[model samples]
Target: MLLRSTKAVFTACTLVAATAFAFAPRTAEACGGCFAPPDPPTVVSGHRMVMSVSQTQTVLWDQIQYAGDPEEFAWVLPVKPGARIEAGTSAFFEVLEAQSAVRIAPAIVDCGGGSSSGCSASFAASDEFGDGSAAPGENGGDPVEVLHQGTVGPYETVTLSTEEPGALNDWLESHGYNVDDSSQPIIDQYVAEGFDFIALRLQPGQGVKQMTPVRVVMEGGSVTLPLRMVGIGTGAQTPIVLYVIGEGRYTTQNFPEALIAGNLLSWDFATSESNYVELRDQALTEDDGRSWITAYAAQNFFNTSVFDANFNSTTLIQFYLNQALANGELSSSCALGLGYFSGTVENPCPPGEPWDSPACGSVEPGALDSRQLGCVGAEDIAVALDGLNVENVWVTRLEANLPRAALSDDLTLEAAAEQVPVNNILTAQIAINPEEACGNGVIPRTIDVSNVPGNRVAALMTTALASIAAALLLRRARARLARR
Candidate 1:
């Protein structure tokens, strides 16, 4: 009786422990040693460099390995002992990686007397693939009966032809398929335009302009096919514009005086990254001795990224963007990345006059509003390139105007004083004050008379508009006077 009682208690205890564990929360898995980023960034030997490059030592794997992450990745200097390190602020080269796997889902199916394997395909194992503009070769592979190679359009549904159409479920179960469920993930992929690799081909140093898109074939199941493409040089300031637009990285960034005078060098996205995917896919094509990837995803990634490179190091650091834009590029592009004249009184002011004047001058504490007057930090971004001939640059100005002045006035005042439609009133600003305003309901304006030197200037007052016009006499005189 004692032994049976002990056994029953042990069984109950085991069940209780299992039940408790089943409901316990799981911990987030720590990601380590899973990915190695793209190229070990280094200063290219032959590239031009204008900024005084710096590097800091970061020991990894117990001093067995050491690397330097630059404040910015451009023409960067490698890490050497006793070398100055670049200060890191934002981002660095990161590698996108994934573990390839096969998955299937199970369901009820009536496989009606079909051949083994349930499904069939016209199979072709070829040395050639990724025919961007090329047709499939007639002699590539032996045709096999295949179930699916295309989308299930309405007209092509299996409902009309097959009596036992649930063979997809049967095939999936037999193959132990695990479909990546959740329609949201697939839809999100399309909306985000996210890809493991973006294939692009471009001329050397062309950058974003040449970044063409390459697509992957996603059937019912996950298939990581090899992709390859080429991109062209966009030469835009932010090469990664389209990829990061909704994320608020959109801006006109400028890099002024980043190059040295005399050498004319241009920047380009390096291609070493794509070489990886090309080798991994080991893809073949219809073309004899051709690999499947013209450029593989692993290989194509290299073309999608931006690298600050020197086209000509000795050229004047002050190079202009190919086409001048109305506004400047990124703020840091001029002040930080290129290392222009910053850290002045315009930046974060350190307890001084002018910049640190009155608190009521701005809406935010310790920040300058656009309306305030002082040595502006933004002025530094306006690079006055000496050699460029920028003709007829329109400088925009904003001004506030209210015709009646008083909200109580029942006045229908329409004012557009800037551009004169009539020949006489180009600069004429019509100010209509109610009869009661000149004295009764008027508030006196506090005009600073400090520049008038003790307010000694004499005032010659004209009471009537017709009298003022008569003093000018001719229409041309009135028109000329209207200018002032």
Candidate 2:
């Protein structure tokens, strides 16, 4: 059957990390539409979700690996109105993870020795929605309506809404999606709430390896995640990690905040991240079930040079011009040139080089370099970056260990009144001491510290005191002998 491509309405899922299924038959009824096929075998792993929000704009990136047949791989997500879906760079996630990852310091040990006069310590620390206009009554006679059809990366996406749950199921089944009766109740719930569903399928001939990160940009709202939908195809326990970027930190509105005890944190070895995962898991488990734990949060300013490659001189010029207009510095019809300076007749471009010159295309395609030809100057880039309002920003990372049972209801997030800045990168760690009685039982490698500053200072001071006392004793003896 030919699939109808058009436009409709619904709510969107927050950062539900990608949950995998084996396409098994359901023994019991589930809450939402099941995307898994019937009676399949073998459960798989690996699900991760990342989200970044700023003001009214939210960017959600989901990473899921399909171990099943490439043709059978499909993803269905619920989104709110005016969400624009796009393909995101995997590097962005990598950068964010590395920058925001928790780090642990090296364990310090005091060897068995006499009192030292001196001691030294050292420490080290480290998308817009598409603008396509939609007309009413685009789909013929079906309660399910297609709102928008677009391709993001390797997947073909269709945004849909339907008043009738049965029609929605039929529409999905006809389009080669596996929607069973178990998903009916969930569909009914979303339909009743007037939520829109986005169905994504790998394009024909595309393998799972071709799948890249998918980004969904939704309009402003308290960031909400559709837990019910996520729990549909997963096991009893699923792990979710989310990164939220905004003006401040965020917390779960429904669940209690899980706190990791700093006292329990310790450095295992200098190079290794110790017991962090274990501690994190323990914290999640201790917080009852389905609790949100703040992992990392920080406020940072990014250099404009980071995004230099994404914009060209033409775009930059236009961007500044728009800013000038918005700030009432220029009229709407004001003409701007590359060399245009405030009341200056001289052009800023070097010799024959004009601002509009082809040499000034954009930043070079590699690492950020202000000296690269075609790159916007540092000052101009800074101004442009300011327009984006990203200079001063907060990044909050939250994680949850959720059982399928806890995901029965949708999750809503509430921003924290005060955001704590993650001034240092935290590493997973367990405390270790050279003489500690209980630990991993593995003795840490010892280093010779006899020549260390504290040891040397102590030895020198002891020798000096001994010499002074000897001199005093000798002087007294000499005086007594002389008197005799």
Candidate 3:
């Protein structure tokens, strides 16, 4: 009974992660559950390093940097074929430079074929916190090498030929591994006998075209849009500002929502480093209660992106911000400082236990009395989406036309989705309750995942600290007994 109670507590505490996602954690079976793959591979490629450890995750609707709607807290990685990984082990990925990257992560199931603990994130980002891009196994600071991903699947190698020399050779050299055929970097695998890597069919290199006009189409209760560049820019013009003025229903707003969400994250607008505007409700019961995030037009090469207060029949994205500008939604930016999110912008260290006991937004770095604007136009879309009421209106896709708002003289969105391998690129799934906006107290659902690094790291730290404190208290109790 004690063990059962403890397990229940641990599981309950584990769901606070904002990174829960839709795509399963690339496993034949869901984490904590059993599954079987069809015609499994016989001689898989990678299956060397496998460890099994349980971890916990925190959940939230990350506004600026995480993902479009919110991010699901789960572990993800692209493996080279022939990897010998298992549960309880960590896998590492190489990262470039010390920069940040924003993404709306997709929840991918492993070779074992299992769903992730949570739904997919509409928006997921690394840079919003202002540190830098965190490789797969990073807790804080430098990324630790993850040799084995916790995902459950047969290890295999990619079986494709390419004219472009892969960075495999250089990667091997850096990792102190040989570049022989038997030593080729493993990418990913599904069937045991076959090998596969996330190959780029339409390579997004040579830079994504600019001012590329883009659009998306919608249907009854479903919207499917393919995103890609329309044209490449040779010359420069004053960066154009595209204000998106709509009601507080933004998440289910479709591709336009994804596009704006991406731009907001990439531009460093979500960080606490800038003067931030806010709107939030103390009551969790309020729908589209009040929250709209926006910023003034930057006189830089980049364009201005803002969310306005308006409503519409169907939420469609835009390539223009003229309507928003006409409505005069520009706020004052005269003396704004880098507004903080997650309360403390630079969390010298990850906040654990009792820290957020009162709540994350309970404390403040800037206006102590303020909260940043999110879902400003989030509710309107939520209502419309809920009205559609498909078994799953909780779905969205990636944007085609990559955005462009030149950087401030020294600022750059170094974090580009293309920078990550095509396989690493994914979209988050959002499931909002028109009935329960953000307050699903008992967010009762089964959590299914195997290898969540973020959770492992947090759990290790939390449990370790707790263990130490308990030990100290026990020592004191023994001393008292001896004295008696």
Candidate 2 lDDT by residue in tens digits, 252-300: 7767777766445555343333455555567777655667677666554
Instruction: Compose the digit string of candidate 1's lDDT tens values, residues 1-484.
Output: 0000011000000000000111011110110001111243322111000000001101100000113331211100111112111111101100000000000111111223221111121111111110111122321331211222211111111100111233322322232322112222322222233221111112223322101111111111110110100011101110000110010111111110011110111111111011211221222211221211111011111112111222222101122210011012213332113312211111232221224445323233533231221112222112111111112111111101111111111111111122111111001011122111123344323222224432221111111211222222223323543475
Who wins the lDDT comparison? 2
Best by TM-score: 2
By summed lDDT, the worst window of 10 consecutive residues in model 2 runs over 122-131
RMSD of each: 36.8, 19.8, 26.8
Please write out the lDDT profile of model 3 over residues 351-390, one tens digit for every residue: 3212223444342343212112112211111112211211
Model 1 gets an lDDT of 0.15
Q: What lDDT would candidate 3 get against the real structure? A: 0.19
Measured against the true structure, the TM-scores of the candidates, in listed sequence, are 0.13, 0.61, 0.16
Task: Count clashing residue pairs per candidate.
Answer: 58, 21, 109
Sliding window of 10 residues with minimal summed lDDT for model 1: 10-19
Report lDDT (Cα) of residue 233, candidate 2.
Answer: 56
Distance from true position, residue 367, model 2, in Å?
24
Indicate the residue-level lDDT of 173 in model 3.
Answer: 36
